[model samples]
Target: MKLYIAEKPSLARAIADALPKPHKKQDGYIEVAGGDIVSWCIGHLLEQAEPDSYHDRYKKWNAADLPIVPETWQLKAKTQTRKQLTILKKLIKQADELVNAGDPDREGQLLVDEVIDHAKPTKVKKQNAKRLLVSDLNVGAVKKSLSNLKPNSEFIPLSVSALARARADWLYGMNLTRAYTLAGQKVGFKGVLSVGRVQTPILGLVVRRDLEILNFVPHAFYEVLAHLNPNLDQDINSQTSETFTAKWQPSGACEPYMDDEGRVLHKGLAQNVVSRINDQVGTVLSVDKKQKKQNSPLPYNLSSLQIDAAKAFGMAAKQVLDTCQNLYERHKLITYPRSDNRYLPKDHHKEASQVLAAIKNNQGQEASKVDGANTRLKSKCWNDKKVEAHHGIIPTVKKLQSASLTKDEKCIYQLISRHYLAQFYPEYIYNETQVEIEIAKGKFKTKAKQEVNLGFKVLMGKSELDSEEKLPALIKGQKLLCFKGELIEKQTQPPAHFTDATLLAAMTGIARFVKDPEIKKVLKETDGLGTEATRAGIIELLFKRGFLKRQGKQILATESGIALIQVLPEQVSKPDLTAVWESSLSSIAQKELSYQHFMQPLLQQLSDIIELSKTCDSSAFKSLPEQKPNKKFRRKRKTYKKAS
Candidate 1:
């Protein structure tokens, strides 16, 4: 009998629908015609065994057991899903052929492969297993995937990479967490000082940012503006009187009075410029005009979608991920929600008509915008080569069931649909004009953008519109009169606290925060702090651990969090180490690096970190508040009133 093991129950049903008809659903497996069966795992059926699993002595936290590294890694079935695991084992033994149908990503590949390994299938059956990659759950997409299966062995490296990551995190987290917790306890702080490869660095980022904000000192700065009018015939007053304001561009001679960022540091310098240029005749030095076109934004990747949702609706990252999952799994209104790629497969262009129609039917008030989209127009988002393990999140061809969606689901679905629809719209066109004028031997510059065509901006709403001033017509060497000069004083402000949108943006583009060029380049090429499937969860975990708290919409580190970061070694508190590990993992996935090659150095580093944790100064943790023990709530029983 042929057997198919899917990643989850919904996926199993989708796969069954695409196979031969006459399906019989059983308690844990689905039987199809022609003696084929399909089964699924509930997410991950197994997880890495905890430290205590290796030895009973390790169960209690102690500094002596620091740097606990397992000689050989082991997997243990989760208690909640043992029944399903048993059913899969029996089915694997009975099947003549097997297919691994997991999601198209590293974690997905590892979860199903690990299950097959634990089941101990026949050598030939395991070696000859087929792989199915499905990003969309619709019947048509699943059918296409069924016709194009590859050998599952080809993805062993991907699975190995995931395994290496899990083991590495286990070793690092267990050893360091125990080591630090012991240290904190010595300092009279009782909380569990948990540390992780990714979560620790994230906490460090917040703690450092909060410190910077607290230490910042605001100072005053000065600026000069010139209001000029066009003198077409070299006349002081012309019949055509249109005036424009230009900002002062300090000359090289003004360096002594400016800051590194070119902001005027002295009030007297700015006042002098204003005094010299006020009510003086000036000459237009240069006028540059160019027409430009801006293509519509690509479809939604999980990070970009989360960022936008946070900006537009004040939604948290976890909330957005949950809503997207509901839309993808329960409603089947959209494709994969955990995609990191923003480009679509070129073949998807063929289904534009159906997707647009579905959007029109689903969208209530925004239906009119769909009519204006030209289906023939193709944007740069349709690039087959740029498509990664999963394509961008988009609306499926299936018509939306509006009544089944929640308010959050509706908002997210509309967002995905609009981005998809924008692909068929024309590019936004505009004319950019810049004018450079010379007044009293000082330079002044002004820029303006005029919209030639609204194009995709119409669907994007008013946020994308360019609200810059539109410059009047001017020519080089043409005369102009400076009506007046204004001196403006402003204060230099410290950076704003991290918000949901900005924090996600920072994590997605973490390279900007790195100082080392090589590490920065690597982080730029790979996903930043964590994978798309895990970033939201990682952030939420910090909140649950009390390392992060929310003040209004801003995310801040708690006192305990700050104390932990201050006590930890610099290497553990920075993103540089994680960035390097991410690059190595990507190499392992591509078969360019071996699992041992990545883990060997990590093991050594883990030992060094554990040793440091044992002796690090714990003074910072002394002031931390006492840890509160968890209180379990119990229900009260009601007494009968009949006696009264």
Candidate 2:
């Protein structure tokens, strides 16, 4: 019998539904069409064995057994899902062929492949495994993918990279967590000081932001504005009369000396400028008009989609991921939702047309506004070279079950579908007009924009509308009356706390934060901080571990988080280390670097980090509030004494 294993049960059900009839449901496996059995992995069926699994002595958390690098790694079935693992093993024993129907990414390849290795016994003949790369859960895509299954061996590098990453994280998290937790105990700190390759750096981002906020001192400054009216003959209150605000330029010594932030440092100087420009008639220095065009935003990558959902609905990052996943698996309305690529394959033009048709039929008036112009097929979004493991998240040809969607699901679907519909619309065209007016000895500037074509904005609604000031028709040499002038006092503000949207952007573009040149360049070529599939979980982990807290929509680092950063070694807290490591993982995936070569240096670094931590001062941890020893431990001691 042919056997298929999927990443999740929802995905397996979608696959079963797409296949021909005879999908009889069983306890864990499904009797699908063509005598096929479909089963699903609940994410990872087996995780790397914990440190205690390596040796019983390792469980006591002794500094002497500092770096616990296993010679040969072990895997254990997750207790909650061991029964499912058993079911898969039993099926593997009976089946003549197996299909690795996991997600189309490095993690997914490893998730199912690793389980196969662990479940199948040594005596059982190894069945030929084929990879089924299905990005969309729709019937056509699923059938096409099954017809062209690639040999599973073709993706061994991806599995190797995934395994290497897992092992590296294990070494770093396990060894370093033990090292620090033991050190903290000596200082009377009772809690575990958890650290990971990605989580720690992300924590540092929050802590660093918190520090900037705590140390920020608001600076007061001033700005001068002059209100000018064109056509002096017309009454100011008349509908035809045009007026605009011009900002005074700081070119002269007497004028306010502008600071780096563009704020005038001296209010008296600004007041003097206002007084000089007030009630003066000035000639327009220049009227510059340039036409510009803005293309519609590309389709949703997981990160971009997460950002939009957060801004529009105040939904958390994880919530957006879950919703998008539901849209893909449960509804079969979109392609795989956990994609990093924002462009579709060049050959997807036919599929694009089908998707557009489905959107127009189901979504109603908003989609009808999309022109589907002649140039739609030739858009830059359809580039074969740019398409990576998966294409951008876009609606499928499947008729969307819109009526059944919840409010949030509807909002997310519209946001995604609109992007695809926008590709056919023309660019948003506008003419930018800038006017400079000379008032007395000072120059004042005002700008405006005129919309030439609504284009994509017509479908995007009011949120994407351009609100730039509209300039009144004027001649370059004409003079205008400065009807009003004022000095506006303002205070320089600190950077805003990170919202879920901004935080996701920061995590994806973390290379921008690094000062080191080498690591920054490495990070630029890599998916920053964490994979799109993992970043939401990483953020959630931070909150669960008390490293990050939420206040309204803003993310703040807790006191313990701050203390952890202070005490942790630079390699642990800084993002540069992870940036370099991620580069190696990428190389491994490309077959440019072997797993051993990558692990060799990583193992050496792990040893070096442990040595560095031993000699380092531990006093930095004392600043945090101390917690009493565990009451359970104290009770255990009293019971032992009574038994003795």
Candidate 3:
């Protein structure tokens, strides 16, 4: 009997339906067409052999037993998935041929690799063992995959990459977690102290931002403002003879033209601009006109979607991730939500319209909100060439059904559904007009803008539409007269505290004081802190570690959190290390590097950090905490005596 393996049971059932009759199968295994018997593995059936599984002495945690580097890692049956293996092994041993039908991804590759490694089917019988990858697990795609099975060898590098990443994470997580836990116990803290190589650096970002908020001293400054009347000219403003007022701007607040002090460059900047506005009389100097259009926004990947939802609905980063997971996994209305790509494949364009139309006829929706452009979405942002591993997040027309969805989850889903439809529509078009006014010798400006095509605007809110509008149709030298005006003075404030949404954005796009331009550019290309998947958890880690605290929407650093990097043994908070680590990780993915190369340096850095931490003077930090303790622990403790 020929045996077929599937990535999931639902997918296996789909393939079975495509085959001959007798489609019903027992439990998780299904039979396909042409005498082909099919079955599925629930994600992973085997894993790297545990430390205790190898050596009895390594079973328990001890600081004296520092790095748990094995002679060579080996595969072992994962207890939870062992039942899956017992079935696959029994079938493969007696099968005429084995079809490897896992999902087409690194995780998928590892899933198959684990079975091949532990079950040893090839050792018993080597012939007819082949691997097949299906981009989509539908019946048609599955059938196509069966006809063109690729050799297991073709995915060797991918498996290698997955293995290396897994091993690297295991080595770091196991050793560091042990080391820190032991170290913490030695220092009188018995709690488990967990630290991930990726998680720690991310925690550093939150801690640093928190410190900035805490240590931040506001610098007060002043800005001058002027008011002008509206313009009614041009297509946007009004193509009329009536002119609008120019914008009020800062005028001389310092010494105009300066004395021997020689501070002011512009004599106009020294005099009080608001006081001068009263003395100001005006004339029309110029008007400029420009036709404009706001191009459609690209399809969102996980990170961008989270950012938008967080900003709009005030959801936390981890909350967004959880909702997205439901949208992809349990709900299955959208594609994989963990993807980083914002582009679609070339073939997806024609199918995109159906997506838009389906959204309009949404089974559980209120109304067809979008009635703008029925045209296609063609933008540089949607090109297939830019995508790798996975395409952008998109709805699968499954008409999302669940027992229930939380209000926030529903909002996030609606946002994603609306965005998907909007991407297929034409660009929103608009006009921009600008008018300049001269008051006594001072100039002010006003803008008039109008929407030409309400394409995606029909689905968008006022905040979204207003962000894209600009002045249109006012020509240079066009005359404008202002009747009413007012002056307002505002103080320059310190930078705003980092919100969770903004913090995530900053960490992903982080920058540092760099001496080298080339190095800075590389850091820019890579995420400023960590990848999209790791960023959210990292922020949560900071909060959990007491490095950052939230007051409403504002993020502040705890005393311990502030002192962590300030008194740290190394410059761990700097982003250069993250860039370097990412560079090595990328090399491993490209097959140009080995995980050992990455691990060796990290091991040394960690060891050095440990030693240096011992010698450091933390007297100042001794009184302060590395981070604030979790707030749950700080609740009022009402002592209760046993009933006497």
Candidate 4:
């Protein structure tokens, strides 16, 4: 008998539907004709045992119990999924061959692989196991995946990488959470101070931004614009007259009067420049014109999609992820929703016609945008080498059931479809013109960008179209008249508070925030702070823990959040550690680093952190409001009387 273990029930059903069937649904699995069976794990059937499970003394949070390192890590069946685990165990023993049919990512690899380990199938059966990677739930996609099953052993590095991440997180989060919570208790704070590998760094980002905003000092800056006309003799109101504005560029001699950013700090300097250029004749020093083409934005990766949804609809990251999951799993309308890669497999280009047809038929008014899409046009997004474990989230060829979708779902679906359709459209083309003018020994310049071809922008709506500015044809050394000069005053503004969109963007592009060049380089090459699947949940966890709150659409760190960051060590609060770990984790996935080599240093680091945490000041936590205890219902322990 062949046994297929899937990540979830929906996937199991999808796999079953693609097989030769006369299917019989059992309590926990489905039996197919030809003695094949398919079963599923409810997310993860097992999880890392709690610290208490390792030892009785570790049950309560204690300072002495710092750095609780497990000598031999153990996995215990999750209480809710114990029954499903039992059914899988029995099936594994009866099966002649096995297949690991999890989502094609690190976590998915570990979740199902751990179950097979827990079931303890015969060594021969285990070694002979195959892997089925399915990113789409559609029957056709699943059938294609079935024919391409590879040896499960080939992905052992991926499983190890996932295991290392899980254990590292456990070691880091569990120890730090306990160590910090105990320290907070010492300072009369009532809340359980939680610190995580990813969550703490996220909190640090917000707290730092908030402090920067609070301490910001606005400064005034001045600019001089030369209003010029190509024909000074022509009437100003005449349609034949061509006029434009150019900004004054300060010379090196004026450095003392300017700020570091090239903004003129002294209003007198700007006024003098305005007076010098007004109603004067200026010579055009340079005239450069070029046509540029911009390709449409690539297809939706989870982070990009989340950022856009947050911007357009003010939806939270979790809300967008949930909607995407529904679209991918239940509706089967799109591909995998947790991909970090924005590039699609080149082979997917073959299905462009069918995907385009589905978009045209399903989208109502938006369907019209698909009419001009040329399926023959291939965008840079179709790169086989750039495609990762999963391709970009795109609409499948399945017909849409628009009436069944919610308002948000419809919005999200349209976004994914639009991006995919945009791949087939022509590049947006424009003419960029730069003119440099010299007047009274001062330089003034202006740039004009006029649309040459709307291309994909036609489908993207008016907001995406560039505002056109026309410049009259001119040659270098050509004379023009400056009608008047205008002095503009501006103030430098503080950085904006993080919203759902900006926060997700920060998390994905965290390299921008790091100071160390080496770590920054590594972070740039890696998926940022958290994976696409966990970033939303991490943000939500902060809110649930009272560490973060929202003001309208802005995400702000609460007092408790700020205090926790203040009390923790710098390494514990910054993204540097995550960057280093991700670098090592990637190496582990590529077989360049061993799990032991990664964990040993981490264990030592945890010890050092716990040791340092003991000495840090807890005063910041003392000022925080006491956290109220959650009222949770506990089940009564039933007692049985012994019979004589």
Candidate 5:
């Protein structure tokens, strides 16, 4: 019998449905019609061994033995998942061949491969392992994918890269966390100073934002506006000849009026400029008309989906991921959701019409609005060169009703479906008009935009359509009336606190924070800070560990969080080290570099960080209070008085 293992039960069940007839169900696996057995893994069945797993001596955290680097890595099966492992091991012993049917990514390849390695069956060995990669879990797709299984060795580099990443994380997280926590212990700070490759850099983002918000000083700025009425031709309608407002623009020698921050700092000068331009008839110096087109956005990658979902429905990043996963796995309504690539393989274009037809048949009124995208429209989203392991999240050919989905599921599904449908729609077209007027040697400007077509905006719903700001027809020499100029006083705001949307943005493009150009370039070339699948969890970890908290939607660093950054060296908190390591991981994946090459420098850096921790002072965290004692005390004299 051949054993086929999947990443999740839903995917396994779907594959089973595609196989030939007569199948028997067991406790942990299904004997398929094709003399093969299908089983499933609940994500990762094995994890990296903890520090205590290396040796008993490492159980206790000590400053002397700070950098704990294991010579050979160890793997331990998750206790909760041991029963499934037992089932897999039994099947492995009975089978002559095995198939690795995990998700089509680095982590997925490693997840199932590690489990098989743990079982250590002599007959069912890695030499005979086959890989089954399928983007969709539908019956036809599964059957086609199974017929074309390749040797698992083809993906060795990906697996090695993932292992390198996991080990590197363990080295940094374990050694650095122990080092800092021990350092803090000596200074009366009673908490685990948890650190991570991605987690610390992200924590630095919140801490820096908190500091900026705390130190910000409000400054007032002023702007001058004029209400102008232009002369209208007799042929024009009376309603179309209405007046409009224009802002006073600093010109010629008035450059000093604005400061470096783009604020008009001198309020008196603004008032004087306003007074000079007041009641002055200005000729329209120029009227510029330009037609512009905004193409539909590319489909939803996990990060963009998370950012958009957070904005639209106030869903947290993890919540969005969970919902999308549910739609992908349980509902089988969409393709893989954990993808970072937003572009589809060029060959996938053949299936576009079928997916559209499925949508047109299943979706009711919403489908009618998508008639524009129903045709064979070529899109930039279909570029094989740009696609990686998986494409953007898109609805599968499976037919499902919006009524069948939950509220959150419905919203997320709509978001995914609309983006796909938008690919076939024409670009949103509009004309922009800019009018510049001159009055008393000062210039005033006003701009207007008129929509030529709704295009893709129609699928986004009626409210999302752009509204036109009508401007009266004017000639270059036309003169207009100027009402009394008014000064609008406003205060400059500090950088807004990071919400889930903004924080994810920062985490995705962390190169913006790095000073080193080489590190910044590498971070951009590889995955920034964290994978899309892991970013939400990192932020959630910060919240769970009490290092960060939410004030409304804004993320704020806790006292413990701020103190942790304060005590650590800049190398630990900054993005450069982690980003450089991430670039090395990318190199391993590309076969451009080896694991030994990557780990050597990382291990050396870990040792250096440990050494740095020994000399680091933790007195900066003296003000941060630890958990207070819960026990309350009473005097014995009270009991004596009561007895008397």
Candidate 6:
């Protein structure tokens, strides 16, 4: 008997249908012919042990328990998923053949292998793999993948990296949160006080901007404009003339910036230029045409997909991940959703068309869902060479199980469908135009763009296209109308509040505002800010702790948040640390550096940062606007006295 495991039950069922003599059981799993047995776990059935789980005495929170950093982390079956573990265990023990069939990524590998650890499989086990790594849950793809499973050892490095990430997050989050909460409580605040490695730096960004706004003062500036009536025949070079014609040439255009406070900071005498023209003839400099092709974007990886989905359909990041997971595991319409790589191996290109053809046949499915109409194309996001550790998010050509879809699932499906079809659709082609004008001593210019061809427009089948802004051409100096645009001074805006989108952007890279160019260049190898998987949790930690506040879509840092960075004796909130750590991790991944070599400095820095920040003065940070200094918050009383 062979035991097979899958990421989810829906997927297990799909695999079971392909095998012979399948028997489905409620608590257990489906049994197929030839004495083969298959089972599944829903996501992570086993997890790293919690601090409270370490001992009965540590079950509750207390101030004395400042940092619950564990030396030897253990594993346990999660309470929510123990039953599935039991089923898998029972099958693994009796079966003669074993297979690791989890989702095909770090998280997926963790889910399956950890369960195996729980089951206590025998050594020297000859396991056959059910490598069903397709985006769609179709029968053909699933069956093909099962027959080609590789040995488990091949994925050891991936599992190692995943586990390391998990451990690091746990260590950083637990210890920091405990320390911060205790520290805050000592100062009369009674909040849970949370902290995360990724989140604190992120919160710092918001806090800094808020301070700039609070400290800002506004100012104004003045300038003049003239409506020009030029001659059409002779070429009048405005660049050579000395007058303020550039500012007056346009009907609509933007001037320039402001200083610290929302004020127009201007310096030096105003500059201007003028040109002599008969206002009769304007000669066309040149009308140039060039053919340009825009290739379809590479397939949807985790972050890119999330951003695009959010922009196009207003979906949340977490929501997009969940839907993509379901589509991959249940419907089997797509590949892995948690991947970061957008490129594929050269080998994958050969069979790419099968996916394309499937979507084309299911036009209604390969296209996005339309309102008030049943006839439409289906959705798919696929690329062969463009895929990395996993292929792009694409729908499998399999006929969808429409009944099983929830409302959210349908929306996700629509998002995936549109992206997939767009790949095979044609390259977007357009004609671009550039124009230059010189007026006044200062040069003023305007540009106009015209669309000649939209190649992939046919794939959308006359669907609504993105909007464009362009104006009819004005050949060289052919001035028909005279419109003098006045110089309206614009005050500079304080840095914008961090929205979820902007926060994510800032979190994605470790690039800095540092003065040194060399230091900035080194961060290129480092994953920006944080990976997609960890960024949300980091932000959540900030909110859970009083360090950050959520006001509708905007993220504001709390007083504590500002103070933490201000008093931090060193740059704990700086991206420099992230960059250094990233460079080390890249070295580790390439076998060029060992873990000890990488972590020793980190541990030292951690100690230095914690000690330095704990003892430093926070005067500058405390004065920030976010704290609303002098305003008091009433302390909440957790303990009540009755009938005194």
Cα-based RMSD of candidate 1: 5.6
For candidate 4, the 10 contiguous residues with the lowest summed lDDT are 635-644
Please identify which of the two predictions, 3 or 5, would achieve the higher lDDT against the true structure.
5
Q: Judging by TM-score against the true structure, name the best candidate.
A: 4
The whole-model lDDT of each prediction reads: 0.86, 0.81, 0.61, 0.87, 0.81, 0.57
Clashing pairs in 5: none
Residue-wise C-alpha lDDT for candidate 6, range 502-578, written one tens digit per residue:
66666665475444577678776565776655566566656655577877766787767777766543365666665
By TM-score, highest first, what's the ranking?
4, 1, 5, 2, 3, 6
lDDT tens digits, residue span 89-185, model 3: 8877768877677665667767766675566676534434678765443444356556777777666666776776677666666665555444443
Q: How far out, in Å, is residue 336 in model 5?
A: 0.8
Q: TM-scores of the models, in the given order?
A: 0.95, 0.89, 0.77, 0.96, 0.90, 0.75
- Candidate 3 local lDDT, residue 280: 41
Q: What is the lDDT, from 0 to 100, of the residue 590 in candidate 5?
A: 80
Q: lDDT tens digits, residues 167-249, model 2? A: 99989987887677667666666566777888999998888888999999988898889988887666778887788889987
Q: Which stretches of candidate 4 lie over 4 Å from their true place?
A: 463-468, 628-644
Backbone clashes per model, in order?
0, 0, 33, 0, 0, 55
Ranking by lDDT: 4, 1, 2, 5, 3, 6
- Tens digits of per-residue lDDT, candidate 4, 279-321, equal 8999999999999999899999999999999999999999999
Q: Please report the candidate that would top lDDT against the real structure.
A: 4
Candidate 5's TM-score: 0.90
Candidate 6, overall lDDT? Answer: 0.57
What local lDDT does model 4 show for residue 245? 87
Clashing residue pairs in candidate 4 are: none
- In model 4, what is the error at residue 25, expressed in angstroms? 0.5
How good is model 6 by TM-score?
Answer: 0.75
Off by over 4 Å in 6: 24-26, 51-71, 118-123, 126-134, 212-292, 344-386, 400-410, 438-442, 457-486, 509-523, 536-552, 558-571, 575-593, 616-644
